[model samples]
Structure formats: structure tokens, C-alpha cells
Target chain A: MGLAERRRILELQQTILPERERELADICGRAIPYAVDWDTFADDAEALSLLEYSACHRVAMALRVVCRDALGREAVREGLREVAIANVADTSAMALTFEGGVLRLRGAWGQRSAGMFGDAEIGALLSARL
Target chain B: MRILLIALLASTAWYGASRMRGASATRRALRELGHVAVPRRLADREPEERDGLALFAFGRVPGSPQYMGSTTPYAERLVVAAWTPTTRAEAADRALRTVALGVEGLTWEADAGGDAVAVGTGTYEANMARRPAWVLVRDDSARGLTFAYMAWRRDASREAALRTLERVAGSFAPALPTAEYLALARARGGVR
Candidate 1:
């Protein structure tokens, strides 16, 4: 990766990172009523390489939303269980699972057949099901 | 006979000096991780050297099997491991991979001061059974280090296990003149 290529990747990351964070925050805000903290880890190399070539990535991001207090934890847990149960047939870019009381949301943007789960759609699904 | 006696005396002095140097390094490393003093119930076990880090176990819970890189003997174990400077995300990812058997859920916290903590549950791969475990990952980026503390219990109650974990986590005191412990406490929402 030359300076120009590195710059391109950096610029692309700068553009997409905040958007992803906002999208995730919006989804969580609408889904859970409590004060939630977001922790995210992304394998940016693959995402950036794919985005540079085809504007898509197989694994875009993995998010862990932690609800600290007991009430908040319980609320997130119940909401995740309900969403998982209700959306058994739904195939989207995002997958939601509850593990050890934390909510995990993973996104794969390369799967064009399975449409991306926009914040509004996710929020609606969560709000309706939760 | 005189030459042999001198050689023996010199060898003994050299060994003593090297041991002193090793002890000093160990103390400094422990202090860097905010362990001012070893807890009463715990004894320092030989550190395990890995690829780029060292895992230090500092306690032996009664009746627990001896496992390298694991102090997962319920309420009385403190395992601290440190890594070279790295991003919090990378450090955390590596720490979890290195320390825990299998991380189920993680609760991450960070303060403006760049101190971060990841608390989570896992299983302790022990002799008889896989025991429930708690792992705490403390990120000290300023010092170019990441520390992981793990504890596991044989009992069944998760609540009690968590309490014991917190108690053990709180027992570590900060090295003098550094407020890293306070920062960690704040990030963890005063878990102690």
C-alpha cells in the first residue's frame, strides 16, 4: 500500500466509521430504553480492501451493546430474545444474538441478496417485536 | 584448594546478584499492573512466557488443580498478564483470545483518560469440569501495556461468583504516585 492508497483507505474509513456508529446507535436507541454502551471491533483490512474494489465487504462490523444496570440488562435481554424469536425467517445484513446478557449485532455488507438492515428498519423491527 | 574456594565464592555471588535483579524486575512489573502488594491468600507462581507476553498467576485456591496461565480457582485467584503497546481494540481482542477459555459476553467501559476495561464471562478449562469464569481486561495504553485478570469458581451461583470476582479485583491497589487504579475503577463504574 503506497501513500496514496493508504490515504484512500484512511479517507474511506473516516467516511464510513461514523456513519456505522450512528446507524448502530440509532438502532440501539430505538430498541432498548436504557442507557446502553457500545463496544465495537472491526476487521478493517478486509472491509477496506473490498470497499476499495467493489464498495462492499463481507464482514463490516461487530457490535456489543452493554446494558449496565439490572433493569437495563433485563430489558435488553428480553428484547433480544423476542426479536430473535420473531425474526426467525428474516434474512438481512445484520444478525442479532443475546449472549451472557449482552446484545451482539454483526453486519455483513457483501451479501447483496440479503438486503442490509437499515437503522429505521431495525428500529421498527425491534420496537414492534420488543 | 584456594582457587576452587575463590571460584565457588564468585559463582555464589553472581547467582545472588542475578536473583536480585530478577526479583527487582518482577516487583516493577507487578507494580506497573497496580499490584502494590500480593494478597494474603495468593503466592506468586512462576510466570509463563508466551509469544509476546507473560502470564503471571498470583494465587492458589485450596483444592484447585494447578493450571498454568490460570488462577481460576474461584474466589481466591489473581492472574495478571501484560502485553506490549497496542491499540485498545487489538489489545482487548488479543487479551480475550489469550486469557479466556471462551468468552461468552463482554461489557466494555472506557473513560476520557484512555483507560478501558472489558468484563466478561468464560469457561475455565480445568481437570475435572469446565468451570464458569470471569475475566477482566484492563487497558493501559499510556504505558504501552494491557493487563488481564481472571477468576473462576466451581460453584453454581453466577451472582455469588461475580461478587467474589469483584472482591478479588478490588484487592489490587495502585502503585504509588499513579492514579491508574482510580481511572480503572471509574471506567469499571467502581466495580470494587
Candidate 2:
């Protein structure tokens, strides 16, 4: 899937569905390939924004899978969104980028695996086939 | 003889100047956090410890040290820090994430206070490479608590660090933040 195609699916997911987990998972499953299989996102400012949003939503989904509680999942999303917003696009040490045919994150701390993608949880989820 | 005297004086002055870098406040903070056993040898050594920790009070005051701690080998270290959020729920959410990450799964439970979450790494004996590190992130409106310690050798340092954190937190009474500190802390939203 391509960026345009992924965006289309996201639009559909937002408009058509009643925000169910299984449905959201199906949409994300289809969109992962397009999101991760890209290179040279260097110049596109909009792509960066989309990637950040997608990353946040996907991470929340992953947390929901582990948490299994709607309230807890919502809390995680709110907390993560606060982290994402406070960091900002330019100033945040953590940011979404593309390089060498895969998406990358910069300026994370802890074990290479821990902060390898700025947010370790997101990195783990994105890297996995799920 | 005159030249030797001048050289000795210069070297002594340099040593005195270098020692001054560890300010009184730093010493006081460390002491308040825990006692520091200063080593006998003070030769050429890295300014910060290989496994070290420090607290940063976000603010505009020059009182806060510009450089709180070293940033090298961030992976080998774990940091427990606090950020003043508007509500207790927000703080609990932040604590939950830390707990989830520590246990590497979905197992986390908040304590009775609703300010902290507890999680454990079980044991590292099975995997020698896994450093035994534990994290506790707590939010008290006046003062936040973040407890982190790394032990690679199964030695005394790890236990000492944990004990110190517990003692300090038990007696914690944070001073009221100045107006400047509050404004700057709000602007700086994330925990260090």
C-alpha cells in the first residue's frame, strides 16, 4: 500500500466503522506495509505528521491488546498524546523519520531495543508483523 | 628554587579550582538523597559516575544546575523522574507506562495511594546480560518520586541505592516552587 492508499483506509476507518478493535486491527493490518515500506521521506513535511499520528494510534492499539481494558487503553493514549504534543515536531528529541527503505526514530535513550524508535513500545509494535 | 615554588603554587591552584566544580548544592542534594562515600583517590577521573543519578528541578532560576548529570551510555542506565501534571490521574497514567515497560508485559497494579505503580523484572540470573534494574515512578503533588538502580555484579551498590531512595522518599518534603520555577516547569512538560 502507498501513502495515499493508507490515508484512504484511515479515512474509511474513521468514517465507516463504529471504532471497534477488530475492525481497527484489520485496517491497520492492511496499512502497515505501506507505512513501513517507504524510503526518502526526508522532504515531505506532511508525511512526518501522518507518520507521527499513525505511530501514536498504532501504539495505543498495541497497548489495548496487552491491557484489554478500554478505560486503561484510553488513558494510555491520553498520556502518550501529552508526551507527543509536549515534545513538538521540531524540538522533540523523538521524531519519526524514514531512511534506507524503513522508518526510523532518532534521539531515544536506554537499551538500543528500548529507545531504538524514540518510543520503545511503538518500535516493538511497528517492527513486528502484527 | 624560586621556579619550583611558583610551579607548585600553580598546580595547587588548578587542583583547588577543579574541585570547586562539585558545588555545595550538588553535595547537599546528593547527601539528602543518600550519603556519598567519596573515594580516597582524586586523580584523573570522569566527572560523573559510571552508574550515576541526579535530580533536576525544572525552572528559570540560575539556582538549578545547568548540567545535572552525564548523558553517556544512556542504555546502561535507568532514570526514574517526575513531572508535575495537573491531576493525579495523569500522573497514574505516566506511572503505568513505566510499570508496563519494566515488566515487559501487561502486568501492573497501582498502590493504595494511587500515586505509584509497582513492577518487577523477576531475576537476571537466567540471562547474565540482563542488568537487574527496577523502576518506580510516583507522583506526590509537592515532590515526585522516581526510583531506579542498576546492578551488573550483584554487589552492594544496587541495594545501597535502593535503600537511599526509600529513605529519602519516606522523609520527602518538597519546598514550594518559586513562580519562575512553576512557569518554566509548565513550559517543560516532559520528565527528565
Cα-based RMSD of the predictions, in order? 20.2, 21.0
Q: What is the lDDT of residue A102 in candidate 1?
A: 37
lDDT of 1 by residue, A25-128 (tens): 44344342211111111223332222311111111111122333455345544555321111112344356544543333343423322323433333343344
> lDDT tens string, model 2, B123-172?
22211123243443444455534533222222223344345335434544
TM-score for the second chain in candidate 2?
Answer: 0.37
DockQ of 1: 0.01
Query: How large an RMSD does model 2 have?
Result: 21.0
- As for candidate 2, its clashing pairs are none
lDDT by residue (B7-62, candidate 1, tens digit) is: 86566445433332333111212422334233344466655444334345564343
* Candidate 2 Cα misplacement greater than 4 A, ranges: A1-130, B1-80, B85-119, B122-128, B142-153, B156-162, B170-175, B178-180, B187-192
In candidate 2, position B100 carries an lDDT of 30
DockQ of candidate 2, scored on C-alphas against the true complex (2 decimals) = 0.01
